[model samples]
Target: MKFKIRKSKILRNLFIAIGLLSLGNLISVYLIFNTAGVEAKVTRLLVKLLNVNLEANLPTYFSSLVLLADAILLALIAYGNRAIGGRFWHWIGLSLIFVFISLDEMIQIHEQLRAPMEALFNTSGLLYFAWFIPYMAIVVILGIAYFKFMMSLPKKILKLFILAGVVFVSGAVGMEMLGGLHAEVHGEDTLTYALMYSFEEFMEMSGGAIFFYALIVYIEMNFEKLRLRFKPKKKKKKIKKIKKNLIEA
Candidate 1:
């Protein structure tokens, strides 16, 4: 049976998936703070990694910047690929899984912090975590779907995910390069310094995760298609050759 995907449905699904994933992430955070707790060493490391000075609103500003960039990225992606909008639901579902996994990672990495450890979120943090829900959710569901159904999808779409990963990596490098220039001239605490730049780091991690696994998903989804189109055709041709030889003999 041919699978038909509606564009409107795609948009709706994307929104929903994003919502679910975001919810899961927040829930994880809530649970970690409430139950798991973080390590003291990890807490120090996060503060240092985040580079939050007492004077500057760096954490808040940095978070805002990261999320803003992420949102812009999602918009750009949705614009370029209609599938992002149509398969929006799948993406959203995947996002929930993604967030939970990442959240779990965070919890695992920091099991010694105070219950209300300073997460240091801002407007951008909200945005980053918010849209992040869908990205993570879609990936999670697809991962399971591969093992469960394993329907072969198209190569073009698969390539798109790889391309998307490459593009995102490129953007991260660009951000780092740009930030580096400013840091060298401005100083360590300057906005250009990598330590003070959550925007670039967040993109590197979040975008990287999406595209890296996206490539995996794309390949798994299209594995059957590639086999059918290439391998199956060769099998048919060999059968035809054998039949002709038998007839001639």
Candidate 2:
């Protein structure tokens, strides 16, 4: 059977998912702060589900989903550019980057890079995070390269896209800086560390949610009838010959 994928439905589901995740994260925080005993077990479980903890499960999965969404957007843009006879391979490049990002999100490539980068840089403060050094540089280069392209986009799309980027970066890099300093002094086991990490997770997911909504809106605006479905063709029934029945009659 064929099923249509409506933007409205997608929007609703995405919003709901983000809301529920946020609520779960908040509950975890509350439990951590206020309760003890069996509640601690429940809180730990919730934290795992909500991406507040260091476990590479919920957060990784959610980040992968976000990267996949970004990759889809880039793919659509690449198609649109090609349709318009535009020669911009940059969109394809961005899509490929998102693919890598999605994989990296799940596997924690940036985390693994931390040690090497720290050893090389021998820095402190925000730069002590190490990964952020190269990451910020890449962001700068990409921002410069895509400045004109971003400016050329429709106002609504441009605004949403930029908002998504700013939100994501604020959490990923900005909060990371703060968290790094805090960890440097207090270690990662403190309540403050958990709180900062919780906030970071929320921001990352929130950014992804916003970007997903924006992409859906843009696609719906451009191609109002877009849908994804799978339908199986019905088999034809074989007809039996009836000549003998007519002769008998």
Candidate 3:
């Protein structure tokens, strides 16, 4: 039997996962606010799992997984670009960026830089996190460089890709700014901080889900069919005596 998966089917499953994860993050935030006696431990665990509370936890792991998936899909698309006599290196560069992001997510590399950034900037406003400076610059550069390529994409995919970038950056950068300001003023232990983090994580995951869907659709549209099949079971047969007798006859 063959296993057939349409692009829309894959996208639906990704969207469902994104929705569930978003709900989980929201619940985690609620628990943080309602932490009572016995519920305090549960709340702590949920916070650790759902936000940037700690390293090597659920949210970080899930983010890494999504980024890694994005990197793989981008790499595959790069190969497709090569096959079609397009700018394969450009796609490869984007894929490498995603890979770096995946690694950063798993290792919490950016979090480590926060202290040095704070010291260097000598400010606690938007630039408290110095990484955003370079990050935003890179984003702008990539946007300008790929503007035409993005325009060349099919309208549906182009729209989805742009939407995904906007959502992801809004969370990664926009919410980050808000959280940093709050933490600078009220410390990082407030309900507001937690809520902001929850929204940031949700947006990141949702953006990844959208990007994954777009990439799947792109591959399905451009490449040959994708399917899976299991090998049929073989049956043992008796000796071929009947066949030999018929030949002799």
Candidate 4:
């Protein structure tokens, strides 16, 4: 059997999803802040489901699924490159990183570090959410280690990868740092903080979608068509019974 996928279609759909999610988040924020009277039960439910700032919601699930998709794509590319043996480890390493990131996105493992890191470093202001410190260090080390691998990739892929990384980091770390500063001073229950987090989530989702599109393009360029087939096992003939009957005769 054969299956065909359009890279552009996937990209378009991804952007559409991101746009809808962003709109939903904005609506939830407006309903929460702008509405003066008591909110309806349905409105509260909508806020719970659509709020980008809240965890275990639609936005969180989408982000986690996007990262998981990236991990799967990276693993597929790594498997394809394994035959040629060039930068196989690099591809696999990236796959593992995405896998961890996907899990962290869902479970928020990094959030656990915030308290310990703050206590250890006496962090405040932009560093109020101190979990990013360790993550930033890891990113720097990985970047240094993967410098050669990045340079070796095709120009188109290199550019896409860098763009994805920039967008993701800007949201996951940069805007997060700014949000932390705002949160520390004025607290988390403010319109500005909500908007900051909403933008941050949007950027993160956009980055993942971009990277997923890049992987689809890469697969199309390098692997051509991905296919799957199924075949039934053959059965052996029963000759022993016939031979025994002939000998008895």
On TM-score, the candidate that comes out on top is 4
- Checking candidate 3 for backbone clashes, the offending pairs are none
Worst 10 residues of 2 by lDDT: 232-241
User: Is candidate 1 or 4 superior in lDDT?
Assistant: 4
- Supply candidate 4's per-residue lDDT for 242: 67
Q: Best to worst by lDDT, what's the order?
A: 4, 3, 2, 1
| Model 4: per-residue Cα lDDT over 1-249, one tens digit each | 122588889889999999999999999999889877537888889899999878899999999999999999898888777644545889899999999999999989999999999999999999999999999999999999999999998899999999999999999999999999999999998999999999999999999999998887777777654443233233212466667789999
lDDT of each: 0.41, 0.74, 0.77, 0.89
Residue 99 local lDDT, model 2: 88
lDDT tens digits, residues 1-249, model 2? 122357667767776776776677777667666766635676677666764555576666876887788888878766665655774487898888788778776777788879989999897776667887888898899999988888887899899999988998899889999988888888877788878887887787778777777776666566444443333333211122355566678
lDDT of 2 at 8: 67
Comparison by lDDT, 3 against 4, better one: 4
Clash-forming residue pairs, model 4:
none
Candidate 2 collision pairs: none
- Against the true structure, candidate 3 reaches a TM-score of 0.80
